[model samples]
Target: MTLILAHRGYSAEYPENTMLAFREAAKAGADGLELDVQMTKDGELVVIHDEKVDRTTDGTGFVKDYQLKDLLKLDARFKFASLPNREPIPLLKEVLEWLAGTDLICNIELKNTLFMYEGMEEKVIEMVREFRLTDRIIISSFNHYSIVKSYMLAPEIEIAPLLSDGLYMPWIYAQSIRAKGFHPHWRAAQDEIVISSLDSGVEVRPYTVNKDNELERFFRVNCSAVITDDPVNARLIREKTKQA
Candidate 1:
């Protein structure tokens, strides 16, 4: 059965990457959570999607411009007028603390491809080790080098390469890097792709799949996991389809 990982923490109902979203995602019975991580100017790891805070927060400018203390003042749910309580941007440490109490897995995406925050891999690995969540965490990144560095830092921790478009022989590419999993885009994760990844001793988990039909297709192929915005619906379909 494909594990349902909530993309940016049940983002369909709550603000993406916010603590509220993560809590809601876990409450909805998601097997795992997928989120982005970036470093603040003061060297704190924050949970957010974009390289800048302009899209999601009330603040302007890049996320790296401000210290963690100043960054906390910005409203993460500034655009969500419907959500009564505005959520503050959470630190990676805070999120890890919460996950320490739960059995749910966390896929921490290192958003360093654009900004290329130096020593981010070291910081993230340090946090994971401090929390003793080596088994529960999956470090994924579009910046393959960051994932590679993470693997070098801690071989025991799982690292997955996040590919947006179809990479040629992704399973082989993952194996070349000694990655434990391949995080592919949903459309690119066809039956053959999934099969090859699994057969090569690599796991294939596609991202951002929300529709029922697409979810059903991935589940039918028995992919390792499906990262979706609607984990509740995915969970329901998995239970219904798997039993049939």
Candidate 2:
């Protein structure tokens, strides 16, 4: 089966990265959940997409400038703009605690590519150990070094490298870093790239591939997973394909 990992939780319906979003994704039957994490001024791991709180929240500053407590006060759902209720920025610990009771896998993308968060690897690994969810978590990042450091910190945990463009013979470099999988953008789902990566024993899961045609292409090529905002639709497509 091509795993359906909800991108930013069921973001098409809920405020991205909120508890409500994650719960909705699980309810929609996503195999796993994918979310972004950045460190706050107080060194707290916050589950928001942007380096700055300006896009997703009502706040007007960099995430690194505010503590988690202050970030909590900001309206994270404001960008959704029409919702009457607001969700606060959640901590990584809170999310990990939530995952401990469920069978869902977590693809935690470290949002430190632009603004490096020192000690992020240790903090995340510590949380996974605390929850005993080392097996269920997949640490992913665009920052190759962070993923490498995460692999070094916990060789037991699976690491997936996130890339925007398709790498030429990606498995070579992926193997060099001991990455267990590749989390490339939807554009990287070219047949040759997908086949070569799989042939190298690396699982490929492309991001934001919500459309039916693209979903079909990935499934046809036997990619391991598709990270999407519309898990409901993706699941339906997977089922429909099975019957066809």
- Candidate 2 structure quality by residue, lDDT tens digits, 66-111: 9778989998885587887788989989999998988999999998
> Which window of 10 residues has the lowest lDDT sum in candidate 2?
77-86
TM-scores, all candidates, are: 0.97, 0.97
Question: Candidate 2 regions off by >4 Å?
Answer: none
Clashes of 1: 0
The Cα RMSD of model 1 versus the native structure comes to: 1.0
Model 1: worst 10 consecutive residues (lDDT sum): 78-87
Q: Which tens-of-lDDT digit does each residue in 1-244 have in candidate 1?
A: 7899999998988899999999999999999999999889998999999988989999898899989999999899955767888789999999999999999999999999889898899999999999999999999999999899999999999999998998888988998998978999888888898998888889999998988888888888888999999889999889877876
Name the lDDT value of residue 115 in candidate 2. 88
lDDT of 1: 0.92
